[model samples]
Target: MQISRLPRFIRYASALALAVLALFAAMRPAAAAPAHKTEGELSYSSHSGLTNSADGSTGTASTGFQVLLPDGTTRDVNTFGEAIAIAGEHRGSTITLFEPVTLSYTVTVPDGTTINLNSQGGVTYAAISGSSEPPLRVESGSTVAIVNTGATQVARVQNPNGVFAIENKGTLLLGSFVQVLVASGGTAVYGNAPQPAPGAFIVDAPGSSRVSAVQVVQPENQTAAYSGSEGETVVDLLAYVATADSGVTVPVFQLRDKPAEDPTTPSGAPDNEWVLATGPGGATVSDADELVTGDYTFTLRPQGATGDYYGYTVTLTVSVTMPQTVDELRETYRQKLAHALAAYAEADYLADDWANIEAAYQQAFDAINAATEETAMQEAVAGFQTAANLVPTAAERLAAEQQRLLAELDQAYAAYDKADYTAEGWAEITAAYEQGRQGIASATSIADAQAAQQAAVSAMAAVAQKPADPGTKPDTIPATGDPAAIAALMGLGGSAMLAVGVVARKRG
Candidate 1:
């Protein structure tokens, strides 16, 4: 019978164990799925004026612009129509211009697509139109040169959202356009455009782009310019404008060698026309061959006659300063990194906090190591300092622990009574309590605070009772004057009297 029941017992035990395991498994949290990362794709194509319609033609027409495809392939796009067709086919792709091209037809860029015209690349006599607001996004370092001679408008961007949106981070050279509706997104517009009508070049939502001001974006301090050891200097200028009618002519600025020279003179002679460096919308003028020294001025020239910069000529003088050597820049970065590392070593932080600090430090170190220029190295050092400032120090942690320990000690002191315990016992507790308080007051680290807290807890537990007086029995009788003693005497007398009466009665 025992052998037969053994299998049943084993089966029951196995089933019970499995049930418990399943319960625990159901209660456990599920693992999170890994996040998917999307890679950016670029397409290269040139603007070739071969085909003039969006008829889906895949011919080998070569536009100066190159489209870099996701599969690392190049496609030739000749006409603005072909460019638009290719852009529509590959959404979120970039069409890079390698050579200057002139297109007479309107270019309507598709959504999520970028048209990049490099420093050497320019698009002339093309009208940019959009089906939706912000149908085209002009990337930085591109130039959209629109020279409208006839009554045709340069750009007419309209969307169902009731806003004509064209995000232009590059330069918009509006030359003699009858009407150019631009949503510059706060970028500047250069060249003169006669606002022949009231709403010719309307600066829509957000901010206006009607050339409010022209300022230097680089040589950060207008008074100082950074010059390389080889005497190469770079200066960047940006024009700020407000929303205005096309009737308002856009202001134009010119760089000159001499400040007293006439601003109205056309930039044809080498002496008058300073070589404007090719870059993003913000004109980055650089003189690599010539060693620029002292202060050079840039003046906003008047457009025609009546279209001056609102009678106020904007001028900026930029002084050239000697650039720091690579070795000097490295030294500066090393010193900054050393300072941050020293600070990290002196402070104690939790494991998680230390991990964050270490990661930030590593990034800064990598940045400095990879940096070859003075600006990049300086940026690395500055970034490291900013990151290091956010880490919590050991002193802060110790201070918090000390505050907690002090509060616990105060509570312990409140619960203790000197009269309840013997003098020797209470004295011992008092000493321990004082020691704990002193430890807390003098605590310099988290460990010291913890030790102080332990001492306080021990003092709370060391409560001893007062010792009993000598020669005092628990069951001893009371004195004569006491109430208990009087009751005892009266009982004794009554018992004796009763005994005497019984004896007398027996004698009788």
Candidate 2:
């Protein structure tokens, strides 16, 4: 009957149940284990001299230069005699050469390195005793260029492909011909024609290349001039167009040579000798006017020895296209808006005519930007046209206003001269008129002149009525101390008193 003695089956069952619970708890999935990562450090050991290395920053140590690797690791370079040895560093790490770098030994430019060289500095390679070529070689995809600004500066490169460009605007004298080798997708620009004095250089496969300076053959009566051959007298015109996007500015066309424009001289010819005319394409050679989209030709006829027109004919075609696409329209609209705003800024905004025109233009431009349909755009265009007609152009209005102000100033002068006013009044009026005249003279626009005119008018009216001079003021009576004057006054008083007494007595 005592509970202390449990049945054998019950005790065994309890034990088994406890064991099953423990097994289930162990089978449950454990919390996700933290991800494990491997980290690498830039190992540095100086074999020859003391080397200072930075792990995550750029610094200079007695041994070498240390740079932070892209992988959050630090690399310390201890030896930097000529060009620092960085071939063992990251693949795409950039090494900037701030000073002249000498490659006494073979130095391979890591792939995708951007090597910026000083214009005044240069890169030279030492010729190995046994090798016929310089020890330096630039790897493909390595970009190199000179930082020189003027054409006078020069950049010399030992390995061509190592530098992307020889010189952007300056001269580039290659130590070896490899300098002209452009990268796979890079361009090599030579400041001028590559001359061969040391040796002829070969250019490897570059995506593209450009020469800043090239000699253009002048147009002649015949190709045989200076030579002894008869051929067609033909000339090619450099194509020109004036349209820009994203606020970019394009150079204008010049109908002359690059350096020398005087064609009559030995180096050039007179620009007027050639005439530009509308070709069959109906295009005109106008710089200010938007040319019609078509072909334009330039024709020139030289006088022959016989005093007759030469049989040769020369022509050039120019194609013009107006804005038609949305982008083009937007750019054109911005240009027009700038022009209109400049004019409006110079106009007399206080005047109803100018203000109205300006407001209309602003509204039209706003509508143009807000319009989503062609009809709305057309409406805005029409509105702008109407507003333009409401007032004269900015220049015309300013000129006319100045003329009117001048006339008004002259009239004011005449009125001041004719008016019969005192000197003081005249001074006030003249002062006002002079101030107004000065304003008008210095006025940049019509509003300024109008304001000046008002000032003059106000001055003229500010003069009060002409003052009249009272005749010399009577002298004050002297002290009544003179006996003669006192007697006279007493006699007059007695006479007046006697007459008054007689009249009073008679009336009584």
Candidate 3:
């Protein structure tokens, strides 16, 4: 079929119509939703001038001195602030003060400073303040207060809680109190380092200082360190005895020792004799001996709960002295006592002899006693402590325990000799007593006193029944085993153990 072509103008007209329709369709998508229109400038008025600012961001504004609502505008402000706010924009615009404003200030008139008359607020003295804090203002309804007994400043208040209208810099005079707290970053207004108590201000925090709180400090006392060359000499020692479960007290000591001892005056015999000893409760060391012209070790220990304690270290020192045997010591003591006694006999010449007499008595004590660790009071206490087994056999703890026991044993023998025994016959009897005491005091937690008694009896029996010492015997019964000696050996062990047990229980 022959296609009849329409006129060019007609075709053009159709094409134009289609183009127009397409355009309308595309435009419809954008035009269908209405957009918000730009309104007129916002109106704002304030009597306080411009007091704040708003920073603009993303075509939106941040807060400023004064605010204009509709157009998102603002103005600067100074004082009696007043503003009319309106909301039109979707964004959150902020209004801020020009700077960190001074909340308030307090001026303290130090004592003796003559306070002059003032109108309002505190004294503004540029001489003292330099360029730091601003002058304080007394707001309306606020009264100027003085700490001391004088009128320091004045206040003019128009309305309650309103600012006190100040005129100019000439409003303040000299010698008036300066309100430090008025300016931002101002020096702290302090009457003094805050007093501890019964004062004007109290710090909220416990230990804070910095003019915010009170503090007490004293100068430390420092003593000159001891150098062996000059001061008085002394000797000290420490020993410990505790059960396996008990806490340990270590010695804190500058231990000293003698490499060699001076020989006796007549030649070969040992002189300046020494021995280790402990103090009451095993807390400190005392009476250390066995010296030459040299060094000796000393130590200290601390007390603890029944089972827990710490050892301490201490320096023990003794001055170099002439050699002396036990016999010599006894003789010296005798002479001293005799001299003192003779003086006492002379009524007019008698001086206080209590100390000298005691010394003499102790000297005589030496003659009557063999000086065994067994009878030592402290050693006895320690001996009973051996049962505790707090430390193993291999460690120094064992050696220390044995030492303590030996000291007791020595003391015991000494006592036995002085009591009913003799130095010559002091033998198995003493050993037996020590063993018995050891058994009674062992850490096993015996059921009752009967058990303890039985243990003591058994220990005594052990010594009594011991086989004869086949070799080397004593020269004197008094030195070995006299009747007094035997009886002492028999009873001391158990008695000591019982005493120890009592002490332990009391401590607990």
RMSD (CA, Å), each prediction:
25.3, 25.4, 33.9
- Cα lDDT listed for each candidate: 0.49, 0.44, 0.32
Mark the regions of model 1 whose C-alpha exceeds 4 Å error after superposition. Answer: 1-318, 321-356, 367-383, 467-508
Which is better, 1 or 2, measured by lDDT? 1
Q: TM-scores across all candidates? A: 0.27, 0.23, 0.15
lDDT of 2 by residue, 207-319 (tens): 44422221222332211111111221112221221112112122111122122322123232222234456643554445333333345555544333333222333443334
Deviation in Å, model 1, residue 17 alpha carbon: 99
At residue 125, candidate 2 shows an lDDT of: 22
Winner of 2 and 3 under TM-score: 2
Displacement of the residue 432 alpha carbon in candidate 3, Å = 2.9
Model 2 worst lDDT run, 10 consecutive residues: 223-232
TM-score of 3: 0.15
lDDT of 2 at 275: 47
lDDT of 3 by residue, 252-281 (tens): 111111111211111221111123333223
What is the alpha-carbon lDDT of model 2 when measured against the actual structure?
0.44
lDDT tens digits, residue span 324-383, model 1 = 567767877878887867766634777777787878888988888788987787788778
